[model samples]
Target: MRYPEQYLQFIEKFNEGEYYECHDLLEEIWMEDKSDKFLQGLLQLAVGLYHRECGNIKGARWMFGNARKYLARYAPSRWGLDIDQIILYIQSCEQALPDADSIPYAKAKAMAFPSLRLLIDQS
Candidate 1:
């Protein structure tokens, strides 16, 4: 399936660790169709990463949890992306952080962030 330009931009921003920009790019498309689970999943993933970057552990956890729920149906691939791999990365992020009201900024900053790659079509 052909991907939207904004979605392509989202992927670029996402891989570059510009999570906020990723959100901005994807939210435009997502707003047009709230029922689009795939878009919701990608948007949530971006927001989750943004929250993590900002040291909002609770928010990050919340977004990550919801992202997984939305994206789960799309696994293990969709629109040239590895949905399963993305989900696994989210799982790892959730696992790495402690279940607490808040975590230190340094802790959050020290955590390794995840990046995604689109699967190139050879056909």
Candidate 2:
């Protein structure tokens, strides 16, 4: 499937604290490409962020970790994200690996969506 611009827009919304909007935006891409690990990872992170806004920490952690695992093998940085910064951020997040029930996007997108967020989170 062609990379959709809406996906980019979702990330923009996410960075702006529009968690719900991001989820809604990514859901479109996700529904169309349910089997795509990259999109799944990206969408899941958005949903996780939505959950984070709602205080669902456990769900956020699960989705963020899942997103990272998928993207780690895929090198999502080519699509976005700063490889060097990610390596460093991920290392730090890993070292601290909060044991909370959730991984919050307002504070954890770098280690959550990681590269996908990097593309959208880039100011």
Candidate 3:
């Protein structure tokens, strides 16, 4: 499935710290492109962030694990996304899991999820 020319809306929601909205925005693309591992990784990451922010430790852990595995095969940059940066962001969340398990978004420094941006074509 071909994606739209831009994913700026996703980035907007993400940067706004609207993790749940990010999940919804990306899921639309993911449903159409089930074969895209990158999309899966992204979706998992978004859900993981959402769960983390919402204080759902169980869901956060599951989604992060999936994202780590799925995103491992790709480079740091692809599909206008900084895959490595995202993976590192997820890893940071993993490290803070114990601290975040009982706390909410306001209290967890690791729950601060980064916004994703589509890369601009140089051409």
Candidate 4:
């Protein structure tokens, strides 16, 4: 499926660990269609990662949960993304910081973050 350039940019930034930039890049496209759950899910995912990286455990957990809810309907696949994998990743992230309120910044910072890649078709 053909995707918007901003979506591609979001993926690139996401892979590069530039979560905040990913959120910024995709927010415009998402705003154009508020009902686009896929876009909203992606945006929330990016924001969740950004919050995680910034050591805001509560916010990160909240965003991650919301992202899952928004993305679940499209499970298995959507717009080249393995939604299942993304959901699993989010779950793993949540697991790493189980007690959001009690987790220390150093612990959160020490957690290994995973990168996500889109399944682009070269054909």
Candidate 5:
């Protein structure tokens, strides 16, 4: 199945550091159709980013890990994940933290993607 333009916009939001917006936008698509694995993975990724932005490092890590695992079943080109970029971000995030509590929301926000607003509007 093709990932929609709106969904792509949602991802761009994630790439731009708009975690809450990313979560909200992707929820629309997930609401419409829950069975699409790609969409589900994307939604999970957005939600994970939201948690990270909100200072829920454990939750964010779990969600991101899950998203990565699920998206891995599909190709980056096919699923719209920039695998290399995500891996780098994840590595950075991981390397900075001793534990979840040590991760500041502001720091996470700085590390987050900046296109979350674009995704919300696209939906």
Candidate 6:
């Protein structure tokens, strides 16, 4: 299959705000397609979002850093996604990292999480 079954699940889970599940689903595909840099970046992004939701600021920051490395190659568009917004979102996440680490848990919990989106190809 060009796109694994888990890939579709990842898209669904990610869009549904199930970041944890999205991480798991993306990993299933990433494990099999290690050569796909775009997929690797997407997986890291998913994991980062999950960690952020769970209040693991360190994990989130680390994953976002890793995501930046891979995602840099595909900025505006890649793999049927509009990743420009995502890159910007990640930058904001990086900026918030310090505050998230120092702030109280309840206060940090109020921070919004970025949801992933796929650019639908009408053609």
Per-prediction RMSD in angstroms? 1.8, 5.9, 3.6, 1.9, 5.4, 2.6
Error of 3 at 28 (Å): 1.5
Estimate, for each residue in 1-123, the C-alpha lDDT of model 3 and write its tens digit: 333633567766767767677777877777887987876887787788778777788788899999888987776666556777777877877776764345665655454444454443333
Over the stretch 1-123, how does candidate 2's per-residue lDDT look in tens digits?
334798778757866767678767877777886877766666665665566555566776676677666656656353555544544544443344456766555565454433224553343
Q: Write the per-residue lDDT of candidate 5 for residues 1-111, one digit (tens) a residue.
A: 566676777767766767677767777777887766666666676787677667777887787777766666664434535555554555555554446553776776576
Compute each candidate's TM-score over C-alphas.
0.88, 0.63, 0.75, 0.88, 0.64, 0.79
Worst ten in a row by lDDT for model 3: 114-123
Q: CA lDDT of each candidate? A: 0.83, 0.59, 0.71, 0.83, 0.63, 0.74
Which residue pairs collide in model 4, if any?
none
Q: What TM-score does candidate 6 reach?
A: 0.79
User: Model 1, 1-123: lDDT tens per residue?
Assistant: 677899888878777788888888988888999999999988998898888877888998999999999999998888888888889988988886667757678887887765566543434
Which regions of candidate 3 are displaced past 4 Å? 1-6, 99-123
Clashing pairs in 5: 13-115, 13-116, 15-113, 15-114, 16-113, 16-114, 16-115, 17-112, 17-113, 17-114
After superposition, candidate 5 runs with Cα above 4 Å error: 1-3, 84-92, 101-123
Clash totals for all candidate models: 0, 5, 1, 0, 10, 0
Candidate 4: tens digits of C-alpha lDDT, residues 10-63: 888888888889888988988899999989988998898878877888898899
- Give the clash total for candidate 1: 0
lDDT of 3: 0.71
TM-score of 2: 0.63
- The model with the greater TM-score, 4 or 5, is 4
